[model samples]
Structures are given as structure tokens and as C-alpha cells.
Target chain A: MNVIVEAGANYVGVIGAGEGATGEQMVQARRVGELLARKGVRVVTGGLGGVMRAACEGAVGAGGVTLGLLPGSDRADGNQFLTVSVPTGLGEMRNALVVRSSEAIIAVGGSWGTLSEIALAVRTGVPVIALGGWPLPGVEVLVAQSPEEAVEAAVRTLAR
Target chain B: MNVIVEAGANYVGVIGAGEGATGEQMVQARRVGELLARKGVRVVTGGLGGVMRAACEGAVGAGGVTLGLLPGSDRADGNQFLTVSVPTGLGEMRNALVVRSSEAIIAVGGSWGTLSEIALAVRTGVPVIALGGWPLPGVEVLVAQSPEEAVEAAVRTLAR
Candidate 1:
């Protein structure tokens, strides 16, 4: 069997709670996605709700491509802001795909799932700029106390 | 080009925040990993820190085969709990590998990254059981109001 490895970067994945849409966390997520969008970056997410919705909303509001990586094969469930939806049918395993599709990850305030994505990022050595959580191990671990700082760190890191 | 799809429950991908040394979310994540472990599930993650670490701890505690998918090509950065580590030099894209290799996903509670994973799950048509978050649309959104419920939903969904 022959295996082919192909890589492409069209999006930056954002991980966070689907809840708490009206808090500082939500504000931070939107700002990050917006900054990336204003720079012509496409924002990708799990697509259906919460932070995904906020980021997508921000990216689309800024005239950027908002791609939603959905978990199932159905398209009806996707958030309205998604420009494109890639259905993986892998359930939570699809989290891997979200992180894989991005050149880097910007984690906002998150719970356990965000932690896993960061773990995935750290394990993979992807430059994850954490905005509001405990710092990741070893990598740049840009402890940005503000959204602007997080976006700045990501821009700098991706530039490298 | 022909695409060959592999079948069967070869591994169980566990998604967590990596901060779950102690907490309800961590407890729930551990419970889910343990359940899968008891069922002979081969667990996989980013292979370092937080919920990833906790899940590995749970799986190992239950005597399951744990695979840590690292972002870098180096083995030194991998989690100490992993029995096997797959190092992908693709950096954060390693998240895609973790998702692609698994048959299912269980989101314990999340933040930005977890939301992205959930979006991926919804887009991909993967059956994701959210332990904590808003209700997902289209797919079977098993809102596990508790840890046991989350684990049960994840297992039941995977069985289907």
C-alpha cells in the first residue's frame, strides 16, 4: 500500500465552549477570528454552535471565509455563518481534523475539550497561542492576557 | 483515484482539556476513558498534558492500549502515560490525524478547541456525545447532564 501525505493551509482553527456566548471568552474568540479574517485568514471550527458560531460570525462579518468542520454527514445542523462545511462523520474524533486543517491554533477560554485541542496542538508542536487559560507546555506558550496580544502572538508565530 | 475506507473499532479517540487532574469535567473524561478501556478500546490523544493526560491515566488504569499522537516528530515531548506515540511532524495538523484514525469521539466539556472539534464532528457526520455544551442540531445530540450520562451516551452512540 502506498500512502500519500498532502498538506494545505486555508484556515486557522479556534477551540472553546459552545456555551457562554456573551462573555469575555466569546468576545475574545470573535476578536481573534476577526483579526485573522481582516488579514484574509479563513476561520475554521466544529461549525454548529457556541464559539464556532461567534468566530464564524466575526469572520463573516469581516468578509472572511468561515468554514465549519461538522461532525456528521448532514449539513442542516451547521451554523448559518459557515461558508463551507466539511462533514467528517467521526464524531468527537473530528476535533483532530479541526486542528489538522489549521496552520496554527488560537485557543480562547475553554473547558476540557479546549484543553484536548491544546494538548493536540502541544503534542503536535503547533504554535498554540492561549488567550485565557493555563499555559501549554514547551511550545511558545504565548500567555496573552488580552485578545489583541493573542492575535499578535499568532500572527508573529505564523509568520515564522 | 480510488479511496479505500478501513472499517471496525480499532481505536477510541478521547478528547479532553488536559487540565483535568481534578474537576467534574476531568472526572467525567476519566470515566469515559475508563468505560472505553473496559470495553477493550484503544485510546488515542495528543499524548501530553491536561485532559489528554487524564484520559490516558484513566485508560491505562483500566489496562487499555493508549496511543499518544504528538504534534512534533520528537518522542521526548510525548506524555508519560502513553504506551505508543505517533509523532506527526505536521504540527497542529496532527489533530487531523487523530480524528482520521479514530472511529468515534466523546467531548467531555470544552472551550475553543473543543468547540472546533464539535463543529468537525457535526460537519463530518460523526456521532458526538457532548458532556457539556449547548444542544447540537441534526445528529443525535445526547446531552449528558452528568459524567455518567456523558460516558453512557458516548458508548451507546459509538455502538450504533
Candidate 2:
């Protein structure tokens, strides 16, 4: 079967923890999504819970499109915030999808899962801006203190 | 797109590094694949190069079914060793698929990527057998010295 892949330059990855996200971190992720959406960016996320849910909520709340790349085979499993859900059945490997499909990555508080996406983004030369995410040595991950800064950096990176 | 998802018990995850696998490690992976296949277990992997390729080769060589859950959107990106390639388009997140789909996990020498799968498997109550793989602090990962031992232990774990 042919699965229609999401293709475009307007997509941006908001990488973060799939679970156990702090309430503050979720708020920041949501704001980041809102800011990105205001710029006409289509937010891409892991499509599970915590930060993913919050980000998608904020983006959709701001009347912007969002895509959820679910790890399971059922689209119904995606968060209520997503405008489109693609049940990839790819599991955590979908982290690579979030990185590869986005023009740039705006990272929030994350763990092992978010770190994987950051690594993949760096490997593929996709610009990554960490708002409050794990920092790796020897990799150039731009740091932003707030959601607005993160979106601005992503926009500037894409412009270049 | 009615994408066919590979589900159920015959599936087994062979976890390892995406690259930088030692020649000996690859051999062990291949042998483990062969043994599992002979026992009618369908081998599952990330579907990239190195150990993944070797394992798929050994499984298919023994006339056993093998599935490659690829990180990209193109099936052509999979190694030639697999019997079927499902382009998961999920990147490293695909590790979750391997953990959730398999009845048991046979972990070879791996890096951070395989470590994630191990964590997932342990949490999901899927049995795991480690062959020179990283050990977790609190998880019960059975150790094996050889590919044969690893496969045997994995099968036993599933049986129980």
C-alpha cells in the first residue's frame, strides 16, 4: 500500500518528552507551537502525550495545522489536537520522521526520545534550537530561553 | 492508506547498533537470526546496515521470514537481506515498534538506540536476552555468551 508522506517546507518539529513532562515544560511547548503556527508553520510531533499533546493543542488552538506521527497502527490513538494523524506503526523510530520532515527543530524538555531526534537532526544538517532540552557535546544546538526566541531562531535558520 | 501492520507472537526483535558493529558481532547477529528462523520466529529489526543486514541475511538464508521496519519513507532504503521492508518513516522511534511487536527481544552488542528498545521491552513486560549488550540498572536482562544461547534464552523467555 502507498502511504502519502507529508512533504513541505512549512513543517517544524517541536521535539520533547513523550511522557513525564513538567507542567511548565508543557506550557512552553504549547507557546512554541502557537508561535510557530502564527508564522504559518505546520507543527510536527511524536503524537502521544505530555509535550506532544500540549504543543498540538496550542497550535490547533491558534488555528494552525498540526501533524501527528503516531507510533502505532491506529490513527485514533493520536491526540485530540492534531489536524492529521498518520499511524506509522514505526514506534519511537518516528523520531527520525519528526527531524527529517521539518525544516528546523524546536526542542523542549526531553529525555532519551528527544535526544534521538536531536542527534538525527544534527546528522542530517537540520538546524536545531533547544528551548529547554538536553544539550549534547560537540553538536551545535542553538539555545533559546523562551518560546518566541525558539520560533524566531527556527524562522531565521530556515531563511538561511 | 491501508498499510499492512506486522502484528502478533511469531515476531522477535533483534536489537543492535545501526552501525559500527564488529565483524564478530555481525556474525553472532546472523547466527541468532538463523537459529530464530529455524524455530519459525520472524526476525524484526531497524532495517538499516551492519548487524541488521547480517541478521536479515541469516534469517532469509534459513528460509525464515524477516521484516525490516525502516526509519525512512522509502522501502528501497532497506537492506537486501529482509523478506519484507516496511518503511516506518519513524527514524529511531521505530525501536518502540520492535519492542512492542516482538514476543521477546534478543539484544546483541548495541549503542544508545538498542538501549532504548531494551528499556521499552522491559517496561512492556516483553522478555529480553542480552548477548554482549548493555545492562540496565534495575531491569532483568538475561545474559548469554553466544548467539545460540541468546536465541534459546529468548525462546525460553517467551515460552514462560
Give the alpha-carbon lDDT of every model.
0.70, 0.81
lDDT of 2 by residue, B77-144 (tens): 99998888889876665666777678998888956567557756765678888898644444377889
Q: Which regions in candidate 1 have their CA more than 4 angstroms from the true location?
A: A1-10, A134-140, B1-160
DockQ metric, candidate 1: 0.10
- Please report the candidate that would top DockQ against the real structure: 2
Question: Against the correct fold, how does model 1 do in TM-score?
Answer: 0.52
How closely does chain A match the true chain A in each prediction, as TM-score?
0.86, 0.91
Model 1 captures what fraction of native contacts? 0.11
- Scored against the true structure, residue B46 in model 2 reaches a CA lDDT of 86
* Candidate 1 C-alpha lDDT tens digits along B1-160: 5222224545767775655444776777677777778877777787877778778888889887788988789988888878889877756556656666566677766644454555454445556667774443334445667656665556665654
Every candidate's CA RMSD: 11.0, 7.4
lDDT of 2 by residue, A47-144 (tens): 88899999999998888889998989998889999989889886665666777678899889856567657656775678989888654544478999
